[model samples]
Target chain A: MLSKISFLSLMGPLRSVDIYQSLWLIIEGMVGILIVMLLIYLVVIWVNKIMNKIEMSIDKNR
Target chain B: MGSFSFITQALGEITLPMVIMWVIGILLIWLALAKDFEPALLLPMGFGAILVNIPHTGVLGDNGILQWLYHAGIEASEALPLLLFVGIGAMIDFGPLLSNPKMLFFGGAAQFGIFVTVLISVLLGFELKDALSIGVIGAADGPTAILVSQKLASNYKGAITVAAYSYMALVPIIQPFAIKLVTTEQERKIRMKYNPQGVSKTIKIIFPIAVTLIAGMIAPDSVGLVGMLMFGNLIRECGKLDSLSETAQGPLANIITIFLGITISFQMQARQFLSWGTVIAIFLGLFAFIFDTIGGVVVAKLMNIFLPEDKKINPMIGGAGISAFPMSARVIQKMALKEDCQNHIIMHAVGANVAGQIGSVVAGGIILSIAHGFGL
Candidate 1:
């Protein structure tokens, strides 16, 4: 039972071996690149909000 | 039996291979000193190579200083490059990236070459792990390449490190050619406007910490590399540790760089360093860089299709996405100015260039994790 459970858990990580492992790696690489792009996009949006707020505060003071 | 016989014996040991290695070492030194190419690293590496290759020196043999340095710093643990990241982090200012966040996508896009090279290398008959190490040279990041090669392909570490640093130094020459090949004359002339905005000190302090936590959580194996780098940036941003930041960026960085360069030469012994595999690895490294340039430009061109006219990015700035940092950025700027004398794209190029730095590290971490998962 324990071995079966472990095997099931391994499925997601093991997805990197679907076809030839190298080909899987290429797919994994693309996914990783996309994740980084998403993170950057989110961070940029958040920073823009903060900067806009700060600009507004500075304008009020002036 | 005589002293004369001892001199003759020493001369006899100098084979054609040793002579060839010596000549290569001399050329490296010449490139560093005369051609002004990456002198900080190549000079030490070149001198170390000559020192080790001299007959009977045994500098790369058991109990030798170079061997000890290699074992202590590089072979024993992956500490040197990770520690060097701290200094690198301290030197970086994330302001440009923050001001122009869209440039971060270029960083992600630029990593296209790393994956492409992995597939090509496998097709060429390299094992998956070895191919991954070779592919990482596309990251355009010397430390990350060294880290990956040391972990995954220790056999080819010397060739990969030399190729990584050599190509990094050659970015000024290589990137322009790659850029010219893919880009139109009109695309190169597109001017990007730089809006100077002030990023608050509080956000600057928060940025490194946030990146460290987020990147570490996403890729656990990358914690050491990304964490140390963010720590260095934190020291610079915190405003309370100016002296520490200075030391981290200056003396600490210099000492590690010198040790790292000379120690790497221990692997450059003629027997292992001079091989068909090494030659292929060097050429593949160049191919990876070319692919990275294409990836960045293609992504930018793709994005242009959706955006309004004035806000569109200059596609040439896409080439700056490689992790050569300011050098790649400067090349794009120079090319742009040459095409249209009034155009200034340095700020936008720098934003993408810095993003490439972080993007490369993240990609390296992801690759490391995937390689580990396969138990390679």
Candidate 2:
């Protein structure tokens, strides 16, 4: 984040809180979406596996 | 003599912008009717634009009906968009996405346009909040755009709504055009095998609940939007609430949509609508949309570098990862067919398209959370 600030110091968000805040928001938004989506993906995969196991055991009992 | 004077006074109240707004209103109506550009919303919005823009328009006056709807439906608690989201959530089927969870990556990737647009808007001298509103146009979901703009108290709410819905209708032309700029003919022709595993009813029911929890905890601000959307989806997947799901997806949704369209016109008053900010918002909205398309495509292309030949994805599906839903999914499917007759990637595209829906909602929540965090 500091790197982004200094790098953009010459041409970007340093002039106002709007730009600076937007800069941070953009970085966080992108990464935040990735993290959330990835977690959901993992959850889906885990659920599928767990569900499959439960069904398999049910079939074995039958 | 008094009646004649009253007529003259009314005529004298007409400004050039008011007449211009009437014409703009007509144009929106034409686009909705003649061109079939989101007729469900645009037709009412267009007519209401004229209704609100008329000189001494009653709708803009104290206690006007439109004003009441706007205040109650939108301003007070954002009930309209959130209610519409319940309908939207019920309408969506997450089976395709759950069977192929990796499509969630495309959903996340496709949001690139939003952040890019904000950076551009701020660079071009717009306020952060306004820029945030305009950037959400990339979300490609009108409800999320409206909700975010309302939350941020953006000045360009009307323009953002217009761009969000308009570009959503233009997905066929815009997605293809943007897809072409970054992808090759070969990439567009990449055929993905779609063998969807059976998605159990249990997983289907859990999916929305889990999404609500994940998104709400992280963004906290997204709780209302995600919660309502997931609630609708839960109604659909629960199997016991068939009647409730139908209501949410049908009459309830249709009714809210009608009011939501017309009520949005409250912001279209000529004095407010006619501005440099609106024009810039239109352009920025397009930029956000295009970048979103390109962003998804680029990520797919990057992913291709790591995957084996047989596992390569149709990069066009990446473009479908905006929240346009079945429209985005359908457009990519048609484009894929145009490139090769035998390639059928609709299922994959559908997965990504639905992922895009959740993606856009989460993105909106993320924006609100960040804004509140910064005291913006």
Candidate 3:
């Protein structure tokens, strides 16, 4: 009886992953990855431009 | 017969496995205290291991202080781990990562460990949600692991926390083997030179906000951790808030670590922690970390293929992509310097390290959302 109850509880949560759900998850993961990549690129570019401006300012002072 | 009975009475309570556990506990303590292998965490963990196995110690009993700390600090509201992040944020310098932003990619790639471990856990008979939560332990960041575990599988919180911390301290030992196995001697000795010019104060201050804004929108669940992390970095880079940053980096961080480490230890009592599941989980967590390193290094090597001539990256910094932060970065730099004393990969590695922190948090948030979506 104890084993039966435990088995029921475990099996109760089993959900079949259909095509739509799998697609949705894949799209979600891709979107997350894309956003991370874009943000990283923007930060690198912004930092580079700012550093260049600073270098120019320093050169003018010299 | 009476004298023999007394000896038998005393010896009857001691079990062989229990004795072995105690010896392991003592060895862990020795490693932490004598050998200084992450004494900050291992010492408390070791002492907790000893206390929990004291046969009749009430410290882990229903009304004991250790149990109370577990309830108050960990389970009740997840206070200690989140608060520890505030300290970690304060101590971190974002300048290196901010200057060479490309290192962020390495960080994201390193999180391959968390997912790989999740798949492995599933194979080990854990459900999808529980497996993902358990796998997050490999990200090498405790708070992120705790946050994900609480959200997904609070039942196994104690085991998960212990595994996360133990594996993180083992990085120095674990990573060298992984690094040596993957890379040829010639690759380990490969040198690349690029120095990021000094970053302006304005850009440095703005970088964290931009990251928070970008990452927050993408992975909303991670906002609290990622936001505060960037906020701490913002204060550090802002230059005017020097004193505030110093306080966050020092006393505030140390005090919080004290609370976090001890509170985490409270959950390590033998009754809850000595199961076969716990042992398997530790090794599996290490597997996640190893795969994360492999994923990062491989991607880095792949990236080198597309780089414009003269800009090829040395792949060693890929190991820094794990969320161990300065520790991972320092290890990568040490390895690099061994090959060439003048080589400096710290900046690039720091960038990857910080990126890994953000990536791990985002991954945690995603896992939380997925679990929530499934109503798990």
Candidate 4:
């Protein structure tokens, strides 16, 4: 009985990789990475823009 | 009579396994010296293996020098790899990453291979813990592989470390094969504009701290690994500690690396290393790297669909997302130059490459926490 339960548990994660499930997991992971990448992209752009703005204001004051 | 007896005893103690291990060790030494493949580590490892396997050497026994070093660095508490991380952290210049943080995504994307490999290993009848350790070879960071395997699959630690470091050294060869399979000449020639800008000093110092805090909060298990790495980076960026930074990157790193390499060979006794499982672990490690390359390239290709005409990445830069560091990034740049001499993607690739360093550690931590949660 314990062996049977253990076998079932082992099969649990495997089911998610049967065929379509594998594709979904790949897509999900890819999307998560993409989201993180996009966020980093946006933050960098925003920060650069703000820095440029501050530089321009300082130049104007001079 | 006593001297003759000692010689005879030594000769009599030689076994088939010891001979085989000695041969393997010699081969490792040849590869290190002749081929110049990770000589600093492999040479010491090979010599240590040879020394330990000699009959009646007692080099790997409880009070042996090798045993003492292994316990002090590896067995005692995982101090060796963490110390090496500080050196690695000191050497890394996050300016490129800061300039183009979008490359950070490729780091995350490349880690997909780790999970995919784990799933495959589990399906192939490996225990979940063992599979996780084998899969982490995809992290492409030698220390992370060592840390994970030591904790989860101590028995296979030698094989796992060998696989991880060997593949890392072969990044220049492996990455190109994978990149060519997925990318076209036109995509490879896609030249990214280089715009070098000076980042403020304050940002450089803050970057390591912020990353450590964020990563720690999200994956608490990774704090030790990430924290030590960030601490090294902090020493580098602090500006007032140039001498300390140099020490961390130079002597400190080299010394730890030598110790770590030699100590690891203590586990490479032939009886333990020569097995079907070792072969499988090696092949799985290669597959992990291949998948990591695929993951990076595929994600880059996917992103190109949404990006505008001018903003489309070369797609090959995605291959740089594995934690082989500057080597992977350099391979991408060389391929781009081969495609078109005018093309320059080194900076972008470096950004992605550095991001991979952090991504790999975080991924290792996440895997550790998940394995713990599973009660494995």
Q: Between candidates 2 and 3, name the one with more favorable DockQ.
A: 2
> Could you give candidate 1's per-residue lDDT for residues B264-363 as a string of tens digits?
8887888878877788888999999998998899889899899888878899878899899789999998988899889989999999999898888888
What lDDT is reached at residue B279 by model 2?
Answer: 93
Q: What is the C-alpha lDDT of each candidate?
A: 0.83, 0.91, 0.72, 0.82
DockQ, per-model, please? 0.20, 0.45, 0.20, 0.24
Q: Fnat for model 3?
A: 0.16
Fraction of true contacts kept, per model? 0.36, 0.67, 0.16, 0.19
DockQ, Cα level, model 1: 0.20
Task: Write candidate 4's Cα lDDT for B144-233 as tens digits.
Answer: 998888777546788888888888889989999999999888889897887755676766887777777766666677787888898999
Question: Ten-residue segment with the worst summed lDDT in candidate 3 chain B?
Answer: B1-10
* Among all candidates shown, the one with the greatest lDDT: 2
Clashes of each: 0, 0, 0, 0
Q: With candidate 2 superimposed using the best TM-score fit, by how many Å does residue B227's alpha carbon deviate from the native?
A: 1.1
- Per-residue alpha-carbon lDDT of model 3 for A1-62, expressed as tens digits? 33232222221332233223434553564357547756866876867786788789999999
Candidate 3 clashes between residue pairs 3 or more apart in a chain or in different chains: none
By TM-score, is 1 or 3 better? 1
Question: For each prediction, how big is the interface RMSD?
Answer: 8.6, 4.3, 4.4, 4.9
Candidate 4: where is the Cα deviation over 4 Å? A1-61, B1-3, B196-198
Candidate 2 residue-wise lDDT, A1-62, digit = tens:
44344323322333455566677878899999998998999999999999999999999999
TM-score of chain A of each: 0.60, 0.61, 0.69, 0.68
lDDT of 4 at B312: 91
lDDT of 1: 0.83
